[model samples]
Target: MLEFDFCSTVSSIFSTPFSLGMFTEPLMLLAETAPPEVVAGDLAEPSEESLFSVGGILTLGMLIVLQAVLGFDNLLYISIESKRVEESKQSMVRKWGIGLAIVFRIILLYVVVKVIALLQEPFLNLISHPLEVHLSGHSLIVIGGGAFILWTAIKEIYHLLAVSDLGEEGDKGEKGNSVTKAISLIVTMNLVFSFDSILSAMALTKSLEIMATAVILSGVLMIWLADHVAEFLKKNRMYEVLGLFILFIVGVMLVSEGGHLAKIQLFGYHVEAMQKSTFYFVLAVLIIVDVVQGRYQKKLLARQAKLRLAEQPSA
Candidate 1:
């Protein structure tokens, strides 16, 4: 030990900085301890600080779940809309669309978190008496988005029912808009769909970080699901009809929400917003009915095939 190699020691000392530089913060963080065990639980069995963290996490989780639920329609819309592009490019469009939507959502979150009240401010008024007509920026977006989606859904239904191979036609450049137009619409609708969830999240907990996290998580999930939905529709075209119908209902909800934003009343009946629970219940019923019908149809087909085989003479 007294006769240490001075050259080797100097080399080793110089290499220590290089070794440390190679390990990034993230790499170092991989060996973290359990916080409570490491910090001795900070202050005892449980503290207000710990409880507050748990509450924040719970709220974040709730917002995330809420965003996912409300974004079902938006995801459906993306799947359906991406068909306007070349078949090979549809998936790319979906991924990019969602990526851009997430960016836009975070930007919108910052903007809305600061000026939600301004968005809800009643400015433009067409009438002011018993049939008081007024509008806010928020109401305008909701109403316009509702009308756009309603038109799109109804148009898609009509096209699907009246003519076959709408997707194929688009592939052939016969029933499609420009790719730019398609992506623009996707982003716009995503914004409209996000408004409710973001507003609700703000109301629940005034934490921009939590709300943004929720939106980002929801966006990631939607991106993952959009592919599955598009693939499912491609494989099982029959379900496209069901998806379109659900989208139609989404439009109705948007319109109702917009009406609530405007506080419009007519014939002693105030135009009100649809509850999320009610919307989900109705959607569940629709899905159940569609699934039951699909199973019944399969059984009927199978039975018919059996009957046909029985009627065929021995080969």
Candidate 2:
């Protein structure tokens, strides 16, 4: 007869080399200060006796910091996407959309684990070149998420360039866009942004409690800050277009990454790939150039103003 035990099951879920490496030193200290069982079962949940273990507190802090780092890009994207709606409604949209999308994020976490297990099967065949790609769960997610972001970026760019005014007067073209339509677009894109975040959290731990707490806390923080970000973009209107273009670049990067994950190839080159470090390096150079150009332009304007004032006095 075969028998299963709770300790073995718990160990199988939480006992990993990486987890041990992260917790081992702190756990040793914790063991000396507190009971060994308490240190080991730090995450087992809030019991009456020990709801504030040192290990649990450290783990929560790390998760919060990680979530903050990951959520920065998403927050930027949210602020940019919410520009189409009325100024009064933009903050509400971001707050609610992000909060709702997290529910979907938790559901996707479970789905990805099952899908990754069957990722070896080839799902699509391209052509006579005999190149094939697996349409696994992650592939679909990457592709869908990428395509959605790309579409949003393109649409926003088009609206910026093609339309002279973005105020209510210019919304005649969107006369058919009901409140429902606007909210749907906002919510849809929120999910797209959540895709990478949820997948990243999955790699950290299979503990649903950890993932849920991180996401919930992050969502709350995002909601709190969404309005301020929206207001900042409004005040610094010059960079709105630049910000949208950055989002477009991010979308392209996502598509490239998705292609790489699915082993996609085009003309004998991997389609979905970019060195992240290189991308950031190039972006930094571009930002420096932009700053320099802005300073030079400002000085030129000041000099022109001085010359005009002198000429007027002489006249």
Steric clash pairs (candidate 2): 256-272
lDDT of 1 by residue, 87-198 (tens): 8788888988898999999898777755665776778776645665568888989999998999989998888777666676534633376677778889989998887666
TM-score for all models, in order of appearance: 0.77, 0.73
Q: Native-vs-model 1 lDDT?
A: 0.72
- Tell me the tens digit of each residue's lDDT in model 2 across 1-315: 111232443465466554322322232222223332332233233332221455444445555655665465577777776665665666667777787777776675555445534432446655535465655555666677777878978887787678767674334333334445556766666666665555444433335566677777887888888788777767766566666766776777777767876778656766645544444555566667777877898999999999998889554
RMSD of each: 16.5, 9.3
Poorest lDDT segment (10 consecutive residues) of candidate 1: 25-34
CA lDDT of each candidate?
0.72, 0.59
Q: How much does candidate 1 score in TM-score?
A: 0.77
